[model samples]
Every structure is written in C-alpha cells, then in structure tokens.
Target: MLLKRAIGVAAGAAVVTAILVAPASGAGQADLDSAVREAMLAERGAAASADFGTPVLAEPLVEPTRSNDQGWAFGTTTIPAPDVEHAGPHTAIFVAHRQAQGWQVELDGTAEFVEAVERAPADVVSEGEKQLFARNYENSRVAVADTGLGLPWAEGVAWWMGGGPHGDSGQSRPFSSLDFNGGNGQVLSAGAGRVYKSCLRNGSGLVRVVHENGFSTTYYHMTGLTDLGDGQPVAYGDYLGRIDVGLPCGGSTTGPHVHFSLLRGDSHTKVDGQTIGGWTFREGAQAYGGYAERNGTQVGTGGRITNHGQGTSTPTGVVESGQNTSVNVRSEPRLSAPVVDELPDGSVVRIKCTARGDFVDGVWGRTDLWNQRDVGGWISDGFLYTGSDGPIAPAC
Candidate 1:
C-alpha cells in the first residue's frame, strides 16, 4: 500500500480524517437518505471558508455508501532511540453530524470522548468564530497515507536517476552519514520552509545535497564523500558521494549510507564535513540543507483539505450522494447521500439531478450536482478546480 511503503522512507508526510455524525449502533447500515436530507436542509446558499485540521471522534461513524463503517491503521513511528520505536493502536474513524456537546469517541460499546481528551494533551488551533476547526483537521487527515495502508503516500514510487533506473530500486543507499538501519535515513531540508524533500540514499559513502524546495537528500556509509559541500546545491539524482562507510552502522545495511533528515533550522551546521570542520551557507536552501541538529520539534506535517466541492453545482436525483453525477453541478453546502458525479469539461453525460446548494472551498463556494453511481472514483478536489479566479484551493 502507498502508506505502508511510505513508512520505509520517513522523509515524506501523512494525512487523517474525522466523523461528524453519531450512529445508532456499532454495526448498522448508515441512513444515507436521512444524512443527505439533513445535509441538504442544513447546507444551502453561500458561506465563507474556514481552516481545518485532524479530527477527534465524538461517536461512531456510520456509513451506508462506503464499504466499511469503521476502521484505522498504524502510521509511521518516531525513532526515539537506536532501537525504540513508538506506535499508537489501530483506530476507528467516521464522519458524524449532531451529538451531545463537546467531543465524543466510541470504541466498541465504550463511550469515552471527554475521557480520551483528558488523558491526552493537544495543541490549540482555532479558526475565528468557527467551532468546526477540529472537524476540518480530522477530515483533512483522512485522505492522507499516514492514517491507513491504502492511502496515497506518494508511496513506493520507482527511484529514477533520470533516463535509467537507479541501482536496483530501493537497494541503493547514500554515500555517507552511515548511522542507521531499516530505512533509517532522515530527509532533512538543509533549512526550513514549506519546502518538499526528496529521497536519495546509497550505502557507499558521503552523499548529500540541498534542493530549492527547502529539502535535502544525503547518502551515507559509502566508499566516498564527494567533494561537494558547504555552499553546494543538488537535486534528487545528483551524485553526492559513493557508498562504503566501512561497516559501522550495522550488518543489515552493507557499505555506506546517506543519513537523510529534514532539519528544523535554516542551514547545515558544518560545511566542509572533512572530519574536522566544513563550510556553511548563511541563507537560501544551502544554509538550511547543511548538517545540524533539529532546533525544534515538528510543529505539524501535511494536512487534508476541507470545505471541498465548494462553489459548484450539480443535479441530485435519487442517486447516491458523494457519488459521481452525469451533470456537473458545483454547489455549496456539500450534502452527502446524493454523491455527485462530474465529467471533464466537454465530456458527454446525461443529466442526473438538479439540486440547488452551495459548497465552501476555502473562502469560495460553488453549486453542486451529484451523480448516483459515479461519486466513489470521482476526481479529487485537485482536479475539480480546473479554472476560475482562485482555482480550488483546499483548506488543508
């Protein structure tokens, strides 16, 4: 799975989701019709956009349209020490509407939302007057690979060093840094930014470079440490060094390795890396990519988008909501049950439903028309916003 494999390369990110409705029982078919009607009644006209984050459950997430109603998977673990890895248990999730105040969680027949929160501490994130911040956060994380195995981690893609394949796929390591095992390299941005990081490690020798995206790539334990350093800048396929850092890290990792990590600071602490001291950059991707300890903890990672399907309209006949509709209606106040279907512009499709509603995408809202049978595989919010002044920017 994308998420499973992504765990092997810690340089990337993850996502999560939430349930806003309460279910009658743990094992019962969700009332899609009722939910749709409620959403339709509650969601109408125009509305402003609001920010969101990972959600905590207040109750069981019932689903009649989706295959499974509740389930969760393990995500990446932070390596606290050389041999210690921390992990959370399998989680259950769902989208719910209306429940008794505060937040609630349903584990089997257990009812304990407030108790869970009291046991665990969290950071505060508010979106003005909107009390829906928690819901957005939970919803956003749902689409991410971090929550489940089948999610999109941008995971397990081939390692392409350009026109040809690099090494034998995941077998290749970095040229230096040789300090860990079992995909133990850290993906560091020589500095900080909303920058994206790349994976490039070989078990030969010293290999590291900074990219324009505020990310860094380094290979360790190689038979080399390329002369590039200090104010050096490199990309995914660039050669930083050759593998063979003697056999220090461990046996599972032969030769050298690239100790990749995303630095919380702005640049490499040491430049030359010539055993004694190295060069350093004052600013830019170079300074950030340079070697250095993380100055702080990761505030947060990737996020999912909310107020999705905003500003679009589509007709919703008796078809299932969230499903694809033949007629593309960009509507606001996204309603469930009448799953919407949308075809690329110019595609031929018969009218399905003419439901009038508004969608909230960030700060924009569009009308919507959901198809009865085609909403599951519908285009992502990414493809939905093809044109328009602001385009479709999700509130992830």
Candidate 2:
C-alpha cells in the first residue's frame, strides 16, 4: 500500500502528519500495520521504496506488551524486506497513541518518543514497563561484554557445531552467533527470562529470550515454536522451539539448525573469549572459522559439543483429517510416489519440514504443499492441519 506523509512544524519543531488514511479508533492489526508502514516511509522518504521496497509486517498483531489505559501502546514489529543486504528483517520498536483525530505512531531513536516515554505519568505507563523500555533502549546503544547463557538444548546432549563463531547478521564482524545441528531438535531456553516471537507469520517465527541480567538471546531458523504469548516467563530448559531450516525472517540455511546468538540489550555481542554452555569460544581470524575449548577438549567447526544446559522433550502435533480415516505417507512429494505407511486421523506427527508437490483436495482443502515427517516420508498438507493455510515449516 502506498502511503504519503508531510513533515510540518508543530510548536516550532518537526512533526510527522499523515497525509494518507489514518487508522480509526480501536484499530486492528491491519490498521496498525499501515501505521507502521507509513511511519517507516516518512522516516526514509523515497529511499525506502528504492532500497527495501514496501515494508510488510511479518506476523499478525497480538496484544501490546506495553500499553496503558490511556490508549498508549508500545511494541515491536518485524518488517521483512525483499532486499538482500540485510540478513534479516528490520525490527521496528514503536509507540502509538490515540488522539481525538486518530492513532499516531512514533518510532524509537527519535527525541519525541524518548521524552514521551520518560515523562509519561504512572497512570499512562507503569514503572515496570518504563524500566523495561529503558533497558531495551540502552541495550541497543551499548555493547555487552559477557553473559551467563548456555547451550540452547538439553544437558549432556551432544550437538554438532556446524558453523563456528560468526556474525549474527551473517557477516564477518560481531561474531555473536554459532550454529548447532544433530540433536533431539528441541530448542530449550538457555536461562530464565521472558520470551517473545519475531517475524512470526503463518505459524512460523523466531524466538528471543530476555534474561534478568539485561541480556537477550536470539534463536533463528526454527519451526513448531511455542504458543506462549509475548513477555511470558520461562525457566531454564523450557521448550522454546524446534530447530529447522525455516527462514521465517528472510535468510538462507543449508540444513536444520539453530543460529544462536547472545545480545546485550538489543545489540549482538561478540562470543569470542566468552564462556557458553561450559565452552569458551575463540575466533580463528575468519568468520565461521573458530574453535570451542572446554577442560582441555578442543572442538573445532563440524565437531560435536556437549550441551550442559537443561533439556526438554521434543514437540509434536496431531494430524487432523476430520474424517475417521487415514492418510497415506508417500515416499516422495508426488501422489504417484509409493506409499510407505499410513497415519491415522488424529495421530501424532513429528513434522520435519515442507516441500512443493502434487495438489490434493482433502480435509483442509486443496494445496500443493506437502509435509515431510521426521519418521520417514511425505503427506498431503491438505490432510494435515498445522494451524495455517500456508506452509508453516521450512522448505524441505
């Protein structure tokens, strides 16, 4: 949707006035999405269209994590662009207030938004909410030195260190992340804190955990994520999500693995010389070229590392066909493929990922999307309800 805005003088300062349509009172997700898009376009002007194209919200709207009785709301949104320069989506932390005219959006990093949050009355914004926003603001500006985080899996489980220390943005500097594969596929909370989902759309998204020490961790390329709401508390070893090749935030991966990174506030911090999951990371003078050491055992990239964090059970979902029948599991995505087994209606399924194949009309309507089960072969997604009309898992 095309949006227009005017930069005008208000009280001798710059203020953004929406020239396009404004969201009415009690706006829904689509309205808020347009508001965010307008704010972004106003800030970037024509450059936004030339570079990133039109911004699209990654997920449907949920309840505001920070809001008050005065119709003031604060939350974050992920706008995934088609541009390739950014490894992921652009995260927008915005403040919205309802006025006699309409809803207005003010993004972070602006003087007006900062002052408004700081001086907001107790009734408008609670003390705890203010502190949380302050922490988020501070973390984005400063780099954290260390954290007490551990592996994002169960204790004593061996996981392959597919890629060594690398940039969280898939670049060279700020080696803030490491990739892990070949475990139970269950990703657990590294520490106790609150969890939030980003770039979530059609049942797929990335997870972030904010710890008590003002440190946060990011988990990417995951599927079958938790249903927990934003700002929900989680204990160490709680089930966060499952590792997959899914790129819900716009990126590419070779296999099913989790890109784990530590953050101080919102900024990615270097993992070099930092101890995590009982191993110390050392950079190898190049990205994806590092080794982890623990008690005289040196594990280089492609080696397996023992997880010392708490573990959780694998997540599974039931296959729904509506009719009291079964669906054939094919050896390949096509219906012509040989049938290997059959899954009874309402049977549990551990789905690995999805792939394009023959279109089938079944319980959930017709679609060409097929789901590959962890146990073996493929099944028509039309027969299995995964909570979305579109593909929820990564491409297989």
Best by TM-score: 2
RMSD of 2: 16.7
Worst 10 residues of 2 by lDDT: 308-317
Candidate 1 local Cα displacement, residue 200, angstroms: 14
Q: How accurate is candidate 2 locally (lDDT)?
A: 0.66
lDDT against the true structure, each candidate: 0.22, 0.66
TM-score on alpha carbons, each prediction: 0.19, 0.58
List clashing residue pairs in candidate 2. Answer: 154-311
For residues 128-159, write the lDDT of model 1, one tens digit per residue: 20122223233332322111111000111111
Root-mean-square deviation of candidate 1: 27.4
True-structure RMSD, every candidate: 27.4, 16.7
Consecutive 10-residue window with the lowest summed lDDT within model 1:
44-53
The backbone clash count of each candidate, in order, is 149, 1
